[model samples]
Target: MAAVLEPLPQPDPPGAKTSASTDASHASGSGLKPIKRLISDSRIERIVPESNAATHLQYCSQFARDFIRADYNFCAAKVTVARGGKIRALDAAFRESGEWLGKALTWIEQHPTRSFPLEHEVIELKITHPLAGRLVRCLTQYDRIFVRSMEVLLAGKIQSHERETLLLNAGKRLKHIVQVCIPDNDAYLTDGTRKTK
Candidate 1:
């Protein structure tokens, strides 16, 4: 079980160490296990599963990474950014998308069943194909158009709209994942169909 740490009281002086029992010290009063070391394997597994979550994570993360890199590179080049700046932008894009991918994987794990609109376990093979197309649409933030704040803030008045216009190949990869890969909610492959990941 995850420890619910209570907030610590304010110290007499800023950054001063309290001689009395703090919330952190009180929570681990038993001394049986350190509070920082108390995180369980299940909790870690919930973030990134060792066995089952890999398949979905692989496809979805790849698509996001590719999409971000492509979009950033295009914008950078169009704006006459230096090659080094473009490279740095690509790195930033991947890092941001990686954070999103981790959250997306956790959501996929919890939802479990994505074969239909009603959100139940799917038994048939055909249903999964169409469902991935829809599920990935949500997973990839399809409706939310991300506009970089720095780009807008730096563009001043003249280049604002031109700087933000960009395209991505994520749709092609998404189609391939849904139509061909058919990722299962089960981390393991139970049926005869082999998982690509």
Candidate 2:
């Protein structure tokens, strides 16, 4: 699914003490909407056989990769547009990006493998899946990047050079993640036998 790009409530004005009502409004704003599931149980059952743990892992990884890609693209577009002397707009985009990043991390943490039945049988599959682990770490890094960026933006001390640098770093990271997630890439995949490196 595409990342939600609804308008988020503006942050409190500079030098203004944030009030309780403002905080409540922000909580109920579009920036903090409920997270959508990355993969549904019914979809998993339809696409992956119960006995095929490897395929399930592959499906989960692909879904996560797609979601992150879409989110990154959305954030990039917002940042690009906001670079045209729109600081408040940029701040809103960063806040929205942070929300999506949190959702992605949560989804990764609650990977389907962790909830699969026959724990003993799938324990190794859950622990040993390189793509799943790598995706989690990558998303964590992204979360950190966005949090730091938002801090700078919210503090009203972000310089143009600093914003450019952050965007460059984020783009580089996104490229690395996309490379790692390529389904046919031998670096992250194996022969059709479900062998993991």
Candidate 3:
């Protein structure tokens, strides 16, 4: 005759708290009330608008220059690859250009104006500014072009003529960006006197 074995203990049902467990939780201070966190107000009470504007303008100008350089390098790489140049050269060019693009994109993403339906007046001001918006748009377009160039370069399936067309389009965009950033010196006189055409 074999002795009968006892059934194994089952886990407690969900939401069913035992007295020992509850006592242990209280002992561990888990039952204490949560402390209130100090939250700062969203108002821009202390910030100077003029200083902020100047800083943003300076940032936009610098970013525009960097973006132009990156685009130029990437386009150069594309052109080189398209002209039956070495892949090694294209790889080096792409690596440098990619670094610049990455930094620009990160800055754009972190900017307060990046959020939609601007709740703050300061953000609205930046987003509406001509230079700020223009730079953002140019950088965004450049990002798309960069992706396409990478795909074409890696796949190596596109014809040489097709690559040339892509390069031409990129060059046109780059030219437009450059013209916007750097106005014609002849158009603006250095002195107060107007230049006689």
lDDT of 1 by residue, 88-195 (tens): 333344344445544533433342232321111111101122222233333345212222222233444225444233213323333333322222333223442333
Top of the candidates by TM-score:
2
Candidate 3: tens digits of C-alpha lDDT, residues 1-197:
11111233368999986787664554324232221211111112222222223112111222223443343223322222221222222333344444554553443334232222211101111221323343444445454443344345445545557645654554455454433223233443443122357
* Candidates arranged by TM-score, highest first: 2, 3, 1
Pull out the clashing pairs in model 1.
52-187
lDDT of each: 0.30, 0.37, 0.35
Would you give me the overall lDDT of model 2? 0.37
In candidate 1, stretches whose alpha carbon ends up further than 4 angstroms from where it belongs are 1-82, 117-197
Ranked by TM-score, the better of candidates 1 and 2 is 2
**Which candidate number maximizes lDDT?**
2
